[model samples]
Target: MTTKATTDDTAVRTSVRVDAAPEHAFEVFTAGMDRWWTRAHHVQKGELKEIGVEPRAGGRLWEENDAGDVCTWGRVLTWDPPRTFAFSWLIGPNWQIPAEDAAGSRVTVTFTPTDTGTLVELVHDGFEVHGPGWEGVRGGVGSDGGWPAGLRQFAAAL
Candidate 1:
């Protein structure tokens, strides 16, 4: 079964159970990020060539296009493999990178072992950082085509 709930106005939470171990689930979600990311969700004009998480705290979370242009999404805040991963989400309400990193939000994903599989929970918060158009940021991520759908794709990959 899938699960999703809003913790507050500023945050969106979603989860899914995957038929895989916590380690494997985490691997696919991070190391295999490009495989599950929604192609149409990107802000770039070129086709997405790769989506990457640099695997360390403070490392870059970015995506590259076919033209070799790179868009920096944010920085990794936490990288406890197979357990927890958190990163700054720097895309603004305009669907573009903001003028300052402070305008971004945060995303955290936790992997917990379950009897049947791994429970992967994701939370994207701090929408208020977007300031004037913060609601749009919150609404977009909480929409059906957002985190919930992304988690579904992640589960399907496993």
Candidate 2:
């Protein structure tokens, strides 16, 4: 969750075209998140029941497990429907919320209508906060098994 120096390599951005309208794309990304997001991405130790982003500004992005335990990953920063969405990603290296703002990051997703469907773009920034520990987190999120993989799953679900 560390913020990195504002550089191209520091910000993890990915875009995918989905076979749905902008509104439907937004719904699947937010309201229907649990159906697409993978349990393997959870930092929890039990079976995951759901992972959701509350559909409003300031709402929490959280995960609930079969054991009834909940963990919050971030908070919604903006809630523009069928277009743009942004949130604070506060989880840190130890899989816990950062104690200070400098240790957290931001994630913004945009949905734009195209000839075929909607183009969903995700940008994960602010990794400089981790100071020396930034690279590992960036690699994890940008790797084949990270956000790209998750988005692929999301598109397939749609």
Highest-scoring model, lDDT: 1
Tens digits of lDDT, candidate 1, 1-158: 56665656868998898889999999999998889998777767778888989999999888888898888887899999999999998888888744544556899999999999889999999888767888888889888898988998888887
Q: What is candidate 2's lDDT per residue for 31-107, written digit by digit as tens?
A: 98998997777867778888999889989888888898887878899999999999987766666534545356788
Error of 2 at 116 (Å): 1.0
- Candidate 2 least-lDDT 10 residues: 1-10
Candidate number of the best TM-score: 1
Shift of residue 60 alpha carbon in model 2, Å: 0.2
Residue 80, model 2: lDDT of 99
Clashes of 1: 0
- TM per model? 0.93, 0.88
Shift of residue 24 alpha carbon in model 2, Å = 0.2
Worst 10 residues of 1 by lDDT: 96-105
Off by more than 4 A, model 1: 5-7, 100-102
Candidate 2, position 94, lDDT: 64
